[model samples]
Target: MKDHPLEQVRGNPSRPLQTIRQLAIDPEMCMYALTMSTAESKNIKEAMADSAWIEAMQEELHQFDRLQ
Candidate 1:
């Protein structure tokens, strides 16, 4: 079994939720962007819209899907 990205975030809960938000938010987001845009909103709206990721998050992360 592979480790989930959110699991890594759970390691240091003090780091803030925005950090964890980045992984599922924008897989392609750069390192510098994460730091620079830390204050800015990290929108997972696009990712949440993706059916595959949403299902994976539900099955793997146990987040329920109420979008339908």
Candidate 2:
């Protein structure tokens, strides 16, 4: 789950929605997807509040793990 060291991730608080979506759906952006914690970041809760976003995240997770 560790991100590729050569890859750089940037977050844009100015666009909370977009950032949250990316965080949840784009596992590559995170150095360790399974280790990424939401306890310190409420953005995920805010994003998952929308059912559509939740579903999207689920789909992406499967894709990332090749367990779909």
Candidate 3:
């Protein structure tokens, strides 16, 4: 059987144990979640074009209104 890419880094002293554990559990899902979590629009116009960003911004605004 072929080794997984992450498996090669299992013995690397510089790699954090927690990261290896998380990736070991599900590399593909972990990578997808990381990618989605880091994805951001570079400008307001781009952010406004995405419904997810719109919802997020609206929710943030609602929180500010509620706290004031």
The prediction achieving the highest TM-score against the true structure is: 3
lDDT of 1 by residue, 1-68 (tens): 13345432423445544555665566654454556444332478866655555666778654345433
For each candidate, what TM-score against the reference? 0.26, 0.32, 0.53
Worst lDDT 10-window in candidate 1: 1-10
In angstroms, give how far residue 7 of model 2 lies from its true place: 37
- Per-prediction backbone clash count: 0, 1, 0
Any runs in candidate 1 off by more than 4 Å, and if so which?
Answer: 1-43, 62-68
Model 3 Cα lDDT, one tens digit per residue, 1-68? 13345423324435444554676598885776577567898999888777778999899999999999
* Model 2 lDDT at residue 51: 54
Cα lDDT, model 1, residue 62: 47
The predictions' CA RMSDs to the true structure, in order, are 12.0, 13.2, 11.7
Q: 37 in model 2: Cα distance from truth in Å? A: 27
Model 2 alpha-carbon drift over 4 Å, by segment: 1-42
Worst 10-residue lDDT window for candidate 2 reads: 1-10
In lDDT terms, how accurate is model 2?
A: 0.53
Task: Encode model 2's per-residue lDDT on 1-66: one tens digit a residue.
Answer: 134232223343344344556766776655444454332335877776655567778989989899
lDDT of each: 0.50, 0.53, 0.68
